[model samples]
Structures are given as C-alpha cells and as structure tokens.
Target: MPTDPLERIVETAFDADVRSCRRPHSGSVAETAVLELENARGDVPRRLVCKRGGASIWTGDAIESAVLRVLEQRSDLPVPGVLASGKIVGERGSARETDPLERWACYEFLEGTNPGPGYATLEPTVRRRLVADAGAHLGRLHGTPGLEFDRVGGLARGENGTDLVLCEPTGWHAVDSDTLREQLPISVPPTGDSGRRPVLTHGDYQPSNLLVDDSGAITAVLDWGNAHVTHAEYALARAEVRFVDSYVGRLSRAERRRLRSLFRAAYARYAPLEAGFDRRAPLEKLRWVAQSGSNYARLLGDSRGRRQLWRQFRRLLE
Candidate 1:
C-alpha cells in the first residue's frame, strides 16, 4: 500500500499507479493537488485533481461528494465527476476517533484554464459574454431542485445518506474578524429569504472558480467546498457581487451598472430577481470584503482599516 497521502488516496480510490503529483493553485479552505496516473492501456497518463480537507466543519470529502452528486443528477451544471473518496485511515486500516479527521477525494480533471483576476481587463466582447453566461449559469443552478433543508446554513448528508441537511454556518469563521469576530455586519445572516425555501448556492461563484474554453463559455464550475443551502434571492444577490460589484474600487460606477444590467438580464431568463435585492446586495458586498482572511486579520488590529471597511460597507447600503 502507498504511504504518501496523495499516492495512498489515489491508489486506494482508483487502483491506478501515480506517476507524479503537483500542487495546483487552490482555494483557501482546501489543499488541492493534481496527480498524473500512468495509463496501462496507453502511453499517455490520466490526470486527476485531489482535494484534502483539514478539520473544518465547512468542508470534507463526503460533503463535497454529496454536493457533486446533486449537481450531476439533478442539474445540467458541468461539475467534475467524483472518482473516489474516504477518510484517512491508519496503516492497519483502522481509524481512531482521537485522531484529527482528514478527508480526501479525487475528481476527473476538467480541461480549461481559470480566467484569473482580470475581469476588468478582458476584451470587451469576451468579458460581456462571460459575465452574461455566468449569470445565466448561476440562475440555472439556483433553480435546481432536490435541495430541501430546514435551516439556512452549510449542507451535510442526512441520516439516510440520500438526503441533505443544514448544518451551522462555519464558512463565516473565515471572514469573521479576530477582534470584531461575528460582530461585523458581514457575519450576520440575511433575513430577506424568510418564508422562502433555501436553494443550493455556489457560495464562492467567481472568476477564479470557473474554467473557460477559447470561446469564453464556462466549461466547468469548479469548487463545491462552499456549497450551501440559502435563499434564492440571497444567493442571487451574492452572485451579482461576485460576478460584478466586487470590482467597485477598480470599475467606474457607470461601467459597473452596465455589467450588472447585462448579468441581470441574462439571469432573468431562468429565475426572477427579488424586489428587495437593492437592500440585500450591499450586505453581500460586505460579505465579499471579509472573504480574505489575511485582509481581515490585518484589519483586526488596525482600527483605521476596520473603519475603511465599515465606510465601504455603509456606502453599499447608501
């Protein structure tokens, strides 16, 4: 049996020989790497992306695998196929409850490149299409059914294994300031989705998570680590920020509005926008601000920095 974590997971999952493994740029919550496997039938090797989660309630191999099954079975969204997944076990194949629970999963590698952080610098036509398509894609995702949960929080498999349940929102811990912590407005859950059923939301819908081909159409929506059950309007409002308004400082007001209009128009085809979005969107913007741990950590000790973020937060409301 392979001892190295990567090789162990891959070999255990796929029964394939790991030729090489390389670390790839991944999200803050999960450690992700790509492995090349020697194909027995052909000289070429197969590639798979493996994700390992630390002891965080927000992510795990089982949670992510469950979410992917929903998208694959219920929706038309292009998500990677889960190859194999399980919790890390001991050399004797027994897992101790005292040990820190580390879970891992491997997925078939999708072909495409991330658009990077240059949303404002892309060619005019390409940027517009990408934004519009992303909006539409999210609209479809929000409209996907089979996501039934009583509370507004992250998702976890139910006792039946087929159903999903809501768990406490731990994703907020990443954004909560060490000083202010949950005291910040960003940490407060939005109440706008009251009386509405929680929808399946891609919590981190942004350029970095999307893979695009030469035509600029989204090839795959990557990263289910942030998948959660939330209000449709709340999800839509948050997506608008991720897709457009997060560029507030870099984009002119008129330009931002134009991009937003394009996105809303496209999204409207699949889902309806709520009348209360104007009030809800700003809160989403504040949430986006606190997404960066390093940035929030810096603000924790710096009153001036906290004030600047508050000012921006207030402006979003205005």
Candidate 2:
C-alpha cells in the first residue's frame, strides 16, 4: 500500500518520519487518525492523535484547545492533552500553502473501551455503581468554578485572542407545554432575556463519551468537540436523556426502573434542576440533537443512519 498523502502531511505536522498512522473510526465533523510517533532516537515512541476539520464544521477547535489547557491546569479530568496546536500552513513551504482552516492539531492518545451501547449488559450491581460514579464525576466537573463569560451559549475566539461569547445557536429555552404547542419556526422557544445563568458544561456528556478500563474504572472523558458554556439544566437534560436511552432497547421495564433509580440517586447531588426538569427536558434534548445533527450524520455516514436521527429529531418535536 502506498503511503497516504494525508499521512505525509501529518508527518510534516509533527515534523517526524512516522511509523504508522490510521483512522480509528468514522468521525462526524473531523477526520482523526492515531499516529505512533518516534522520538529522536526512534525507540521511545509516543502515541498521538491527529485531527483535521472538515470545510463547514467549525466547532471551535481553538476553544477546545483552550478548554483542554484549563482542564490540564485546573482539574483531574481525563481528557486528551494538546500536543501540537495552532494554525499551520498545509504542506509547509510548498507551492500550495493552503487555507488556515485546513490546519491540523495533535493530542495525546487515550486508551480504553467505550461501554455506552452495552451499558445495560453489565451485571446489575455494576450498572448501578457506574451510574453513581458517573454522577459523581459529573458533579465534580460542574463543581469547578466556571470561567467568566458575558453571556450564556457557545464560545468563540475573539479578535484579541480571547473572544468568548454567548452564542445563540447553542441551547434552548425551558418552555412550558403551552409554549411547545405554540411553537415557532425557530430552533428553541422564544424566551427573551431569561436570566438562566450559564455554567461550564460538557455540552454532550453521556456514556458514549466516557472511556472506562476493564476493571470498570472511568479512565478518560473523550471528545471535547462539543464542550461549551450553557444552562446547567440544559446540560442535565441532555445527559439524562442519553442515560435512559442506553438501556431503553436492551433492558426490560423493571430493569430500566432499577437503573433509573440508581442514576437519579447520584444525579441529584450534582444538578440543581427543579421538579419540572422532565417537562422541559424534551425541548432541551431536541435543541441539542438539532444543533448536533450534522456532526452525528457525518458520524453515521449512511442514509439509514441519518434517517434514524431525523426520526428521533421529529419525535422530540412532537
């Protein structure tokens, strides 16, 4: 097999004559390949993750890099450490210097299994414990004193090298049933100047993004691609929906009840959501799913998979 041109470009990225580079799986908005890097002596090799974003997807790579730095400096969150970041000329020093968005970055590779889809398959006791553990970790993340922001929503890099904003397309308003019925053609219900304060959220915290060791220990929280600032309840609802979904098709009703009990018992310690969280959760879930539709569609990579997302999206609206 001939050396891939992309691989050569990534080699120039790390400035090392690499050994092997391969894509681990299909990614939605970015193409990611795991590269085993050799040190100067070529013996002490390091594993790194290389990612190149698609043309239209701008999920704030710079912001994510900044978040990773904050996590590395401030918390014990198990996330990828940024290795080689910032803009680089594609095929440096060549005739085709290329666009800035065509840049790439490297991160420390994480190793573990994502036990999301088969979460219910674990022993009953283990499932219960994992839920609690997940809740505690989420609480820890939420407990971190969030960065100061002027408003609530997605973050963006500013012209002064630190311009974060409360981006509108980020989350939804917690509207009532009547509002759901009188819905507009807008993404989320209209709630002008609602003072729901923003907090640091995982943006897409769920079982699938968590990596656990064989011993059932949570190792790393992967994919900060969707991490941003949002309403605390908005984050909670998105996570809760995912928790229920993991067991929905796999377990019996009684079994699901058992797990839900365990999940909420732990989640309560962290979330400040009121009794109406469930009533407002559907709208919140819909908000997240809609904004993330393209990313997930690209991850699905097929018509059938994309249709499944559409089905879910429409159901949420109803």
Candidate 3:
C-alpha cells in the first residue's frame, strides 16, 4: 500500500488544515497514521491518530470508536476523544474491485509518552503504586454505570466480554475464527453470587494498553476494542494476572503481596468478590497459559508439516 494514501485519506476525511501526516509503528494490528493539523481560522492546532483495519484480525475499530464516544461524554472516567470514523474506498491491484473494509476508527492523538521499559526496573514501591493505580482505574471503569453501544452490546457470548482464556477451541488461536464453541468451566469459581454483577469492564487490561505520563502517572487507558459489560471479578482477575506478569522481575516477595492486597482492596470497594473461593479457579486461565506454549509448538509443527492436537494434554503435565 502506498504510504501517502493513508495521509490523503485522513486529510479528506477530516477536511482540516493538515500540516503533515506520518505513520506510527506502535500498534500491532491496525494501519495507524498520526496527522498534524495546522491551526487556522481560530482553530487550535491538533494531533490526531487514524486507525484502519488490516487483513488478519477482526477490526473492531468501529465498535471501539462508538463505545469511546459514549464513554467520553461521561465525566467519571478518562478516555481519548474520538474525532471521526468511516470507510475509505481504495483499489487494490489492477482488478477494478473496491473492497469495503468493515472496521475503521480514529481518535485524537494523546500527547504523553508511554511508560517505558523502566517499569520493568522500578523500585518495589513504584511497582506497587502502578498496580494500585491500574486497579483503581479499573474499579472506576467498572463502577461507572449506564453505557450503551449497539455493536459492543452485540458481542457474541464467550467472545469479547467473557474471558474465554482457557476454553478457546483447539487450534483456533493459530488462525482467527468467527465463533469458538468450547465452554470449559471456570477454573476458579467465586465463593458465591457476590462476585457476579452487571458492570462495565475494559476487557483487555494488559499493561501495554495503559499509557503512563512522564511523571509516572497513568494518564489514559487505550484500546477498548474488547470492552464490555460483564462480571466484575472476571475483570479483576484478568488485571491482577496482567499486573503480576508485567512486574514479575522487579517486585520483591513482600512487594508482590502488598500489591495484590492493594488491588483486591480497591476492587472490593466497587465490586466485591467472595472471600476464600480461590480467585484463580477459572480453568480457562490455565488453558490460556497452556495454549501459549501450544501455539508456540504449533508454529514448529507447521514448519515441519506435522499435525499436533495433544499438545495441550502434554502441556498439562509440564
């Protein structure tokens, strides 16, 4: 694809006085372009990020843009303001065929830098604070009420909101699928019905999705493509695992304990889970971890033209 084509699309889409446009390599799935718009007619200069869908993954960019627009109107949480979103017609190759890509979204560019790899080397106190902040933000997001979106609300069960971490169909991860029909039981069930509640959650809560400013404060959370309404404990469990993995090397034993406590304590304020019902009991979690190694092995299997299905059974032993 021609690089300038994306810039031209953005320019025409917004009709703003654009100064320059450059592609950014930060995102994994989308074709992202950062555009700088010139200030004119009393309009302030602005930075915008345009995201277009790629071939491999399901582009939920349009859904995310719609959801964020709703979330932005509310004052309780922090979210990037969405500017515009629509399809950009383009011809691929000599076929005179115009492909209508279903997913496209764009938002105002956030100015702060990502909290660098220094997070991996931070002191125990700072690490704990990061986890606490993440947990707090998550609690706030889950606590905020009454958000409605057509596409997000329509996400298939066990698809976006529910953590199907363990129940993904065998070999489904190797290539994306429309529907995965494996309903493995929760590995860790909550003690009682206390943990279940109707609430909003940032379904994808990994550390890379968070944006920390230069002052070490988390300024904004990005990537709500997977956001949805679900049980609050499920969201907490996902966040805790992500936090532990992100700071595994830097946290001392005591620090890890304190961080866990902080996260649980904060999460409990808004949506409390049952006590004593091992929080990590979801079978899906173990299945997900095992699938990671399984995916790795599958890669090797493909290179050698071999089929492997019992990798998970073997992974269970390791």
Candidate 4:
C-alpha cells in the first residue's frame, strides 16, 4: 500500500505474483526491497531483491546489474546474481519509452543483514575481523585480470572479460556531474596514483553496501552503482577513510593505530601497497576531505565535523 513511486514501479515491474514485498533499504538515491515471489498457489517461494534506479539509469540499478553480472562470473566474491532487468513497462508512445538505459533491475536476495551505520553495534573484535576480511577481498577484486582495462574508469560486460564501456568514469552509482565533480582526484603521497594501474573499484565501498551473516562474516558485497576500473588506491583511500571514520567514530590514538595496522595488513594480503604506504595515510585522510567534499561532509554527522572538513580542504588547497 505504499504510495512511493519507486515502490509502485517495482511492484509493477514484478507484476502481482509476489507473496510479500518488504522494503529493507531506502536512501535519497535508491530504494530496495526483499520480496517473496510465489506462484498462484503461494508455493515455491523465491527470495529476491529489487533496486530501483535513483534518479537516472546511469546512477542506479542498470549500472549495478552490469557490475553484478561481472562479479558473479569473474570473482568468487559473494555478489548477487542479476535475475531480471528492464524499464517499467508502460507509457505507450511516450517519450520515455525511447530510452534504453533507463531500466530497473532485480537480483537474488542473499541471506544477510546490511549493517549500515549500525556497524558499530557489533563487538569490536568482530568489527575488526570484518574490516580485515573486506580489505583482503578488495585485494582479490583489484587483481582480477578480467577487470584490467587500458582506460581511466569504466564498467565491464558480464563475467566474459569483455571491455569496459565508459572511459572517463564518474563516481559509481552517481550519474550526476556534481557528485562526480566532488570525488575528483587529489594528491596524497605514498599511495599516490603515479604508477598505479586503474582497476575495478566498488566506488562506494561502505557498510550499507555490505551484507553480514549471523556469525559476523561478510556475506555479500552490494551496489556497484559507482563501480569502475579506476585508480584502485583512490578507491582504497576512500574505503579506509570512510569505513574507519564512520564505523569506528572519533578515532583516538589507539584507534588510529589499530585502523592503520589492521587495514594495511589485511588489504596488502590481497593487493599489496607500495612501501611507505602507512606513512601516507594521514595525508590520504586529509585528501579524502577535498575529493569527497560535501557528500563526505554530510556523512561527518555534525557541524563541527563539517567545519573541520572544510578547514582541511582549505589547508590542503594551500
């Protein structure tokens, strides 16, 4: 009975064959639901998740579908399978029908909890292991030869190792120029982009996008709306800064050391960073302010954090 346009669209797209449609996630950009799809007799239930495009095809479900297909085939990573994809069927002879990219997609629902801002709720030891696991998996993701491309950033065709589509890629799941503009590259020493080859990056590799099982094991990585074969370090830096800051909250001296030691060791296990990478994390953390800009500013969760981010941006500029 939800009147939201996204809910209506997803319902229409799936038709009236669903047993239940429980919305599990929603944000400014996208909406998600867990559905129990059943036959007329309410038998043979299939759990499925459907994500609606945020505002445009490029920034929403379409990009995710492409990325999921690639991940499902190439990596052993627990990404969902693309069950269906298409634009909502309606508007006969309307101008919207002409666009092919503006489509919605569905995936098989993986069994796990998406622990968004609540990641801090887990036991500290569990959080530590989960973070380390995420780092190691990222290393494997970056090393996939099938994801290698000669361009700056773009998406791959399903797991067949086909070439990427977009060349000068923006932030994943973001088709908007403004959000993309803010995430622009910034120079941070040590893990700088100098000699690094671009690799497949889950542009917004944060907690909400991760699914964890009951034992605190990461079950599936979700949402490639911002994925691209780009400077893997940029992605890594964003991952380290965003994940550590948001999940750990106000990092003390010990927390900072723990963050650096654990993430670097785990990440290096899969994709080793160059020597002296640890020395550059403070610098990278600052650069994260400039590149992420207002989006990260909002994620900072308070006026003081925003001011500090702004001050850091100004200082980094000088």
Number of the top lDDT candidate: 1
Task: Order candidates by lDDT, high to low.
Answer: 1, 4, 2, 3
Q: Can you tell me which runs of candidate 1 are displaced by over 4 Å? A: 1-3, 40-45, 54-62, 90-101, 148-150, 159-163, 168-197, 283-318
lDDT, model 4, position 228: 64
Please give the RMSD of candidate 2 to the true structure: 7.0
Stretches of candidate 3 off by over 4 Å are 1-3, 39-45, 54-62, 90-102, 147-192, 228-230, 277-284, 287-318
**lDDT of all the models against the reference?**
0.66, 0.58, 0.53, 0.61
- Cα deviation of 154, candidate 4, in Å: 4.6
Model 4 C-alpha lDDT per residue in residues 128-154, reported as the tens digit of each score: 777777887788888776877554545
| lDDT at position 41, candidate 2 | 40
The RMSD of every model to the true structure, in order and in angstroms, is: 8.4, 7.0, 8.8, 8.7
lDDT of 1 by residue, 235-271 (tens): 6766787777778887778878888988877877776
Ranked candidates, highest TM-score first: 1, 4, 2, 3
Identify the superior model by TM-score, candidate 3 or candidate 4. 4
Comparing 1 and 2 by TM-score, which wins?
Answer: 1
Error of model 1, residue 304, in angstroms: 28
Query: Each model's TM-score?
Result: 0.74, 0.70, 0.67, 0.72
Instruction: Give me candidate 1's TM-score against the actual structure.
Output: 0.74
